[model samples]
Target: MKNLDYAYLGPPGTFSEQAISAYCSKYGGKTHACDSIRDIVETIVKDEVDLGLLPLENSLEGSVNLSLDLLYKHSELKLYREIVLPIAHYLLAAPGVKKEDIKKIYSHPQAIAQSGDYINRHLSEAKIVYTDSTAAAAAEALKHDDRAVIGSIRLADIYQLDVLAENLQGDLPNATRFVLAAKADKDFSDKNHLGNNAESQFKTSIICAPEVNRAGVLHEMLGEFAKKEIDLSRIESRPTRQRLGEYLFYIDLMGSSEDPDLIEALNEVEAMSGYFRLLGSYPKTVIK
Candidate 1:
């Protein structure tokens, strides 16, 4: 493959960078940092970048709303793969700044939310300063010895900060799901698979909007997959945006889109739903 360009949400030292590091190791891509998640996605959509490493959901914080909203609205991008990185927040302090010495906590809102219980219990006195990204928070920690940041462990090396306390998340085993997206293929249809890696054990994602919007329409659409013994791994609906109460159901099913059982279920669902979109298929990996 050509040397690919992978854009991520970062300044540096964020979890998205770490996830893309794992990806670039496999795919031989050069990484680029964008100011916002929207920048990353729009660049990928416009072919300014080859791939976008985007955080989709967190084990503790539910969905990353900005990422999800972007994906939902931009149906022209294909989800190339899914990366599940175990999120371990570390409190990085400046030199001589002990746990008790810290008075200000710099963190992304998501990081703050994820570590809320621990903060309330242990370091309740510290003032919270939310930044655009965790790496940005890491930047803040570097300036003040009395301040600390909750960010990636790698930030300690990048910013030369000290790890005051590790494993500060409310849940010790917290993780975030990231998706790699690229400019979508124009001609992809029912017969074709999204990628060669998608030929085996994989997951296919689709967005569905029911035709009639009547009671039980959603239930019946799901029943199509349930009856086929095709397990639905995830099902979440986002607003369709055309009208109030209108919504689109985004689903992840445990098979390739080309799989016979999956094909049958989707066929039934497509007929029942007014709108259906195949958001590509990809293999899933949980990064340790």
Candidate 2:
């Protein structure tokens, strides 16, 4: 096994950290934790790490805009692979503190947003405080008895806190999709699963923008995919951050970029759209 040093979002206990650990354990690698997603990206860009794991989307919460924005901002980084982790948010507090004693609940905005209905139903009186990361929320809650943090079970265990409530998010089918990114593209020929092509599935992600002063341009852009009968799994628009009204669309399609049909669709979209950027094309992880 080659010694692989991977970067992940952490001080510890963030879902990104857990995903990195799980990925490393399953694929044979060593991991290093970083303070922020930007830090992880910086590590990868600087060649300090082999890969950086980041959360791109959550099933319950929708897109992680910051990650998407960062993807746009950092042109050097590329999506090498992706993985999905089952999400389980817990209400954690210091040992001996009962759930009723909690006056404030702290967590990342995404977590708080996803678990809003549950918080309103159960901890309605509790004030919500947003932290940079879920692990930071747990660390903050550890210092006070009146605060409970909504985070993962791994967070509670790492911080030696008690789980006041398990699966507090209310949504039982919660899951988060993370991307494994690196500065260079990946070649999967040496991977273990190459021998078995039975379950192989690939997905390609791209960012594109439609041309200005063009009527029905968006329709024309999409028509390219429709004409090719390409399956677009997801499509989202984010501000291009260039001008006030300019926007960029992020798309996920169900076939490899190498596929002939997908290639034809992409070429057409590229010719029609003002700009386009291919993030990556890699095997899809089936979340069980």
Candidate 3:
């Protein structure tokens, strides 16, 4: 397959950059930096790149709602691949900066949230500051003697900062799941898909909204999958924005779209749903 271009959340040293770098190293691609998730989506929708990689969810933070919202708003985009990157946040600050001297903690909200326990225990007195990205937080920390950043270790080297603490995240198995999104019109060769082995499993994402908000309707809709024994990995609801209380459901199921049982279940769900969309099916990468 020919090398492709990818857009990822950036300003360097972010986990998003790390995720796409690892993927491109194996799959063959060039990486471009986008300032935000919306920027990544916009580039793909505009055909500015071959794919846009953005964080979909974090084990600690649950899900990146902006990613879900963007996927829902843009019908032309599809998830072509997903990668789970292990997270290890370090307390980084400029040389000569002491932990006791720190008066503020800076990081992207997800990173800050993931390291909440550590922050509370070690730097409880410090004020929390949110940045667009972890790398951006590192940039901000570089300028302030009393500020420290919680981010990837790479930030230390990139910003010439010292690592004051390592593995600061509260969770043992911290990770962020990222997905490569592409325009539906793009033709992806087999090489673009990973886990091609015959025994490989796949994951499918879909969006559905009930035709009516009757009682037990959500349960009834999910029953179709339950009856078929199709495993659902996740289900989240986002406001429809068309109504006061109505919502659109985003679901991730553990099977390929081509599976007979999944297809049957999906058809049933669609009939009962006023709005339904098959986001895409992609190879499932098991994270060790």
Candidate 4:
């Protein structure tokens, strides 16, 4: 694969950093760390990077709404690939600190929530502090022996902290799905070098805004896919923002856009909708 420029969230030790790092290791790319999801998307739109990786969903947190919202807003962006990274939140502290010495805990809200049961069970008395990102929490914890952070194992190494507890998240094998997006015109047909036969395995994503809100209209729109027997991996609605009750439907279906059934079903849905966008058909990445 040709080397490409990539963007992701971080200062280092963030899950986004890990996700993009995995992709770069396989495909060869120069990575740029951005401050937020919006920055990553904007960088791609501005052609500052060849691709940007954004977390789409987590098994524990459900969905990252900002990423979805940006997908809906940016017609120029097309998803080219996806990556699933397993989340392993660790309780980290300065060297020489013990569990009982942790008077305060810091982490991103999602990290804290994923590791909630453990925190409540063992560190209930500690003050919970939320940071903008898990890496930021690790940086904060580096300042004092009394503070601890919940983050990845890499964070402990980056911040020179000790791992007080491993696998603190409530769920075993929790993972987050991340997508690689680029301008719609970017070409990435060179998959043979990456060692994965990509064309055969794909998932198509789309967004549809109904022209009107009527009884059973939503069901009728979905019927097109149901009639074709297309397997939908996800279906969720985000408000249109133009109207209070109106919404745009976001869908992920298991098939390439080239498939006859999927193409026909999407055409039918678009025919009955005022706004429609086929985000992209991307190869399904197997979690390792």
**Highest-scoring model, TM-score:** 4
Per-residue accuracy of model 4 over 18-59 as CA lDDT, tens digit each: 777776677578889898788898899889888888878773
Judged by whole-model lDDT over C-alpha atoms, candidate 4 comes out at: 0.84
In lDDT terms, how accurate is model 1? 0.80
Please provide the root mean square deviation of candidate 4 (C-alpha atoms, Å).
Answer: 2.3
User: What are the runs in model 4 whose C-alpha is more than 4 Å off?
Assistant: 59-63, 192-195
Off by over 4 Å in 1: 59-63, 186-200
| TM-score (all chains, Cα) for each model | 0.90, 0.86, 0.89, 0.92
Instruction: Write one digit per residue (lDDT tens) for candidate 3, span 209-268.
Output: 999988899999999999999999888888988788999999999999989999999999
Ranking by TM-score: 4, 1, 3, 2
State each model's CA lDDT, in order. 0.80, 0.79, 0.84, 0.84
Q: Highest lDDT among the candidates is held by which one?
A: 4
RMSD of 1: 3.5
Model 3 is weakest, by summed lDDT over 10 consecutive residues, at 191-200
Q: Count steric clashes of candidate 4.
A: 0
lDDT of 2: 0.79
The total number of steric clashes, by the backbone 3 Å criterion, in model 1 comes to 0
Candidate 2: how many backbone clashes?
0
